[model samples]
Target: MLLMTSIIITISTIILLKNKKSDLLDLKSEIKSISWPDKKEVNQSMLTVTLIIISASLIIWLIDSTLTFLISKII
Candidate 1:
């Protein structure tokens, strides 16, 4: 599409104008210094996030249903 081509050209031109060799090299070095977590730690953290999401969804569903039921009885 024309829109996609224009966007790609704009982004590429901006990057070419702004990004320099030393800046890119510094960014790469900083990225290389990061200490990423192991597989076990990643799995444990993912499980905690999943459980929290499910718990919050169930709580919202319960509250919505209770409000709907109460409103229907009042009408």
Candidate 2:
């Protein structure tokens, strides 16, 4: 779900950029006018979020599989 939402947002952003809808009212040039955050900060934040999600998912999967295996063995 998170991946899907990210993809959707990315695609939408791309479309908006292509159509020049993201341009500011007073900005004359697209490249110079656009305000972008620090690349390092954005990358670090994305890395942290990705790691958290992956770890949580792995933990959940492990717990689910272990329970399933134990139940099958008992039956």
Candidate 3:
């Protein structure tokens, strides 16, 4: 079942990609129209994202440990 589903998805994606020449052209045009961020802004954004991810991971670890401790005590 999983193999069949994957084959069907692959075939459909191939068909869609083959049929999307005009859409791809439009997408290329739209991408060209975009004002991309400067190097310094990109660096700052990347740093912020890294810090946020680290902070979130620490928070999740703390919560998981606290929950595990409480559940152990209750049991």
The lDDT for every candidate, in the order shown, is: 0.95, 0.88, 0.97
Clashing pairs in 2: none
Model 3's lDDT to the true fold? Answer: 0.97
Query: How displaced is residue 74 in candidate 3, in Å?
Result: 1.3
lDDT of 1 by residue, 1-75 (tens): 999999999999888867776688989999999999999999999999999999999999999999999999999
Candidates in order, TM-scores: namely: 0.70, 0.50, 0.57
Candidate 3 regions off by >4 Å? 1-29
Clashing pairs in 1: none
Comparing 1 and 3 on TM-score, the stronger one: 1
Collision pairs in model 3: none
**Highest lDDT against the true fold, candidate:** 3
lDDT-based ranking:
3, 1, 2
Q: Considering every candidate listed, which one attains the maximal TM-score? A: 1
Expressed as tens digits, the lDDT of each residue in 1-75 for candidate 3 is 999999999999999998798789999999999998999999999999999999999999999999999999999
Lowest summed lDDT across 10 adjacent residues in model 3 is found at 14-23
| Residue lDDT tens for model 2, 1-75 | 999999999999899887675355335565676878799989999999999999999999999999999999999
Clashes of each: 0, 0, 0
